[model samples]
Target chain A: MKALVWHGKEDIRYDTVSDPAIEHPRDAIIKVTSCAICGSDLHLFHNLVPAMLPGDIMGHETMGEVVEVGSDAKGSLKKGDRVVIPFTIQCGECDQCRRGNFSVCERTNRKKALGDKAFGHATAGLFGYTHLTGGYPGGQAEYLRVPFADTTHIKVPGGIDDEKLLFLSDIQPGDTVAVWGCGPVGQMTIRSAILLGAEQVIAIDHLPERLSMAAAAGAITIDFMQESVVDRLNALTDGKGPHKCIDAVGTESHVDFGQPDTVLDRAKQMLMAENDRPHVLREMIYVCRPGGVISIIGVYLGLVDKIPMGQAMNKGLTFRMAQAHVPRWTGDLLRRIEDGQIDPSFVITHKVDLSKGPEMYATFRDKADGCVKVMLQP
Target chain B: MPLTNVTGVARSEGDPRVQRKGPSSLTGPDRLARALGWFSVGLGLAELAAPGRLARALGLDDKEGLIRAYGARELASAVPTLSIDKPIGLAARIGGDALDLATLAPALHRDNPKRHNAAIAAALVAGITLLDIAAFKGVKAAHRRDGGAARDYSDRSGLPRGAAASRGLARKDFDIPPDYRAEGTVADAIPALPS
Candidate 1:
């Protein structure tokens, strides 16, 4: 089988590889159909988190068909069934799964626990996350072995078109988390504040494309590049601040502020705490209403410092973190997708083949490509 | 021994490369394999009764290794939800199990004139109930890992839930003290003031 493999920084190549077969009774073999390049994968290209080794298929977001099942991989998931996988490969049993922290399922990432000769690392494993994701061969290939398949992969409803449902891999859950994380999960979170069943959902980002897409999604888009989000955002709301706020613009994501330096101000500082770099996350926390919600969906690799613990403490503010539990909510998300409740397809600014990922990565890394997401085929 | 075991594997070609792949698919037996795979605070006698079958079904060649591995790493890998830090999210998480809105229509709410005021709160509750159904009732969104699979009601593995009283959420500090979930809270947090 041929697959895209990551070898060192900027060294991803499409190469032929061995066929995947079921090794565990619980394992299922999947013939890859489609996958997507994630912002986290870019971290590997920059060597930020390390271990972009040779022949490592680089991707986690995926959908495919069950070619074989290890008997243990059950629950009506049989040959020819289509499935969408969550970023974390988990066994639906265990204290973690019972608690919905499927990301840290006991069987998935326990390095020391699984014994000397085991499936993968002990830590929560991801597809093609290199060291972070247990170095599991990703699905950007022809055939792949899906361990704990029944637990990790959710079968999609038949008859749904592939192109529209693709965002379920990560983005759908991410968007859901934006609201869920900020509101209902607790009080005084940004997402709930900005989104509070408000007539207009206001969003602030430097990226025109993402901001516009957010606007199209019912948010009143504010370009931090042109005007300050805090000041200008009020006009969108009734000067009460956004009812809910979601910081989907992650650390690696670039915003095109009108300022020449394109430097981030409160937006970036509050979102993250630094050696003390702070912005986006904290800003979301800072800006929402007195009892509003703030949802932080940005990706982070390091510890943030000097968080507004005081602001969070005094205001009785609530904070909700983002983890895209897509597998858990796939069916509900799909209904929403099908009914046109949310159309994330608008976020797809560029389309490219699996072979063109490397070039797209370079372009995205340099912030030159207008690429927001790149879809791949196996 | 548990830690060194994996680094201690004897190589085999047919053995899984152990790299990540597309979101994989599942069969019926895989659900059994996944659930039975966990070894809780002591496997108890249940795991010992059926050794080989369970081991084979779960894809584990080393049973003792699994026990040790689960014992050593279980505390961390396991997502423990605490009771104290749980109040709000727990309420929301349990929305799936809560009473039907239609049934509670009388006591929880009275008739409305314009209905806009009551509708928003009702909508929020409805949204929470929907998510609770998805989150706790274990409904997978109608999508697959690889864009090819479909949803099946018969495809369920187990309950989908979040950590409420054990393995607390990572974002929050979980030093909530076990007693919080046990003999938690004094009565009357909800004021007795009349509406």
Candidate 2:
């Protein structure tokens, strides 16, 4: 089967990799119908992200049909059912999963999710990456092998639009991260403050499109390049600051907050002084109202640039951080999507076949095209 | 607590009798961690294979757990007079083959069509007897680590059931030492699903 494979530095290509099949009674093999490139994939393009090397399958946001199933999962799903799959492969009955933290399951991402020795490096995940993960292989190919078939898959409603459901994997949850970062979670820390239900959701970004999408999602848009986000959010909310303040832009933003090292060419790589790190997170802390919770989903490698712990404590703020339990949110989110409360697919600006992703990757890496999301067809 | 099947609220449909067995003598961490480890390995592969069924089955549990663990008990006990709904689909037959997902996948798919699934299907996966409404209510603030004064949380707002929840904590709000702490922190309720 042909899949979009990521070779060494900046080299993404479409090649015929071994096809995927159900090898376990608990497994289900899905034929790829639709997949997309995530913002994080750009990390691979820029060589900033490190994990699986060349020949690794890249795309994660995906939806497809069941071609085959192992014995145990057969009764729960059968041939020909469309489904939305999450990035974090998890078992439904684990302790962490019981608490709804499936992403950190001891068996999935052997090294990171459970730690190397816990599940053993090889005990974890899918295609493309090295054997460190189960290396069972991943979706970005003609077929994807899904483990824990009964617990990890989401049956896509039989007749909904595929385009709308594609983002269920990581993007929507990431978007939810942004929403929470700026909304309800933010409100948790800032008491009596307006919430994400605020009339204006302040989408902060240098790009017009993300800002536009944020506005489309009912937020007031703030282009950091054009206006002072702090000033604008305050103005929009009557000096109380945005009901919720989300940082979708993360450490990549120019003059990025919490980035402590200035010596590097750009994008504060090294971090020694906590305060020297850009002040955005802290600023968001300040921008938050008293008692507001801060919703964070940004990819901060380790400790944040500088967390305004003092103010957080002073204001009774709480910080909720996690990549997202997409499976956990699937049902409710699907309902919301069906109900028309949210339409995240509008974020997709580019769609390409597996072969075309290389150019998209290069362009996305150099910040070439205005690509919010690139959906790849196998 | 071990939950037993007893007469839940006899609804318009029908009620099932579930007996409260005892506090769920749930497994300890080590045991749970091992089970999770094995399940994670197996489930991850299932996801790569049968993500649709995988997601559906997962939702079924959490939904059921949420319902049985919270709603069932609350509903059944609150309105023992109400009737319960009948179980169908894979639910029709319980206590057999563990309703194994791998095996169930074929049936569920055979049951539906159209590119994996494009429909919403929910079922009553488990029975409930005692869902403490109070337990679902969020009442955290264990940070009083050093005997610092425990903040009075008996009057928080913006929560669906905050006032009611806070009212319960008012009595003990001051009793807890500032530093007196509890275990893990949890949300009172699932946030209104992300829009």
Candidate 3:
């Protein structure tokens, strides 16, 4: 089997590796048909997220036809069933999973001790993330070994495009929602907010292409470089801040002259002093309407500096953030896709073979040549 | 066994292992930059730890402090060279190479007893300087983002009924999860609630 393996910072290789086999009664093997290069993958590409060992396969957004199934998973999954493997591995029997908190399901992290040390408590194991999450080889290959297969997958019907189904691994907005960053996730978030009945969806980004995409979804666009994000957001809301602020750009906020704090954050990040650039977090807190909600779907790796907790406390804001408990929404989202309500395929801008995965990583990281999202077919 | 096999104790018995390596995302320049970065660390540590020995060999016995300072500079340059910010570290390295050449020039005078050693050192610096320049240029060219007309995605609304009709479409079938609802907090529902 060939897979994209993490060698070091900014080094991903399409290497030949041994094929996966069923290792437990709950494990299943899938012949991966499609996978994607996620924004969070860039964190690993840049070596920002720790505990990534060499030879680790790299990918998470994936779906495939099951080729083999363990005895325990046979009741729910079987050979030839097409399924989208959510990134987070979960034991359905856990208390967290029963409560719909699948991202923090208690029994999934195989390296629980290491995870506990790094995160205070071990969360769910994630495919291809890091050792702190489980160190499971990812699905960026011809095949993948899925642990807890019975409960960790979203089964999609045939006759749908893989592009629409691959994103089941990852929203809603009410009132006026301001989404920061117009990357792929940000674009999906904009459409979701509109579908979820937000009166207004304001997308913030400096890139013209992204702004145009956001505008297509009927969102008012703010080019932070051209105009003030804070002022424009306020003006759009009639001087009241947006009701909900969504941060899609997490650890690696774009560093620009307009955001001086981002520049300082970059410097600190280079010096190994800061884990995240929270420029967006600071802005969200400072500008969110009093008594408003802050919904963060973005992935924050670790510690962040200089968050305005005082403002959030005084304003009585509510902060909701997590890696998507994918199963919680996938069934409804899948129905929406089937019903022609929302199309997930709109976000994919680049499609290539799995061998080109290495170059695609660079193109996506540099945001070069109008590259937005890449889908790799194996 | 690969390092991952040893350290990834959590991995099950049937997981994949590397069979053969292939082309990497890392370009030639990136590998060169990394090699230069490690070289800098080694040379910098040697200079810092035995500046007196280096000065004596080059017949610049009075310049131990200067050599140590250059060592610190080398180490500082390595930080960025080894980081994702390779260009910055490579630029610093190029500057440090110039300083090294200048310092060696004085030691290369014929009157010095160890002029030959100084000349050898100067040649080595010059070689490394060329490599530094190459790595710097290669890295910049490899990662350069040229500005142009961006690919437009304005037509991709991803809504079959159009963006307008799609608004609140999901609300017809889905209610906000109770744990996730933000609109009806207890304080908002209760007018007499304290701030």
Candidate with top TM-score is 3
Best by lDDT: 3
Candidate 3 C-alpha lDDT tens digits along A6-124 = 98899999999999988899999999999999999999999998788888999999999999999999999989999999999999998999999999999999889888888899999
lDDT of 2 at A151: 74
Q: Which docking band does candidate 2 fall into?
A: incorrect
Ranking by DockQ: 3, 1, 2
| Cα lDDT tens digits for candidate 1, A1-378 | 767776554446665567777777888888877777776676666444433445567777778888888876676578999987777888777786776666666667523343222324344667776544466777776777787887878778777765566667511111212221111111112222222223344555544444433433334456565777667655544555544456654444332344422234323332222312235666666665544445555555554554688776665444555455546556655665565434444444456676666656555543344444667775
- The C-alpha TM-scores of every prediction are 0.57, 0.57, 0.93
Instruction: Quote model 3's iRMS.
Output: 3.4
Q: What C-alpha lDDT do the candidate models reach, one value each?
A: 0.49, 0.46, 0.89
lDDT of 1 at B34: 25
Q: What TM-score does structure 1 among the candidates reach? A: 0.57
Q: Of the candidates numbered 2 and 3, which has the greater DockQ value?
A: 3
Candidate 3, DockQ to 2 decimals? 0.50
Clashes by residue pair, model 3? none
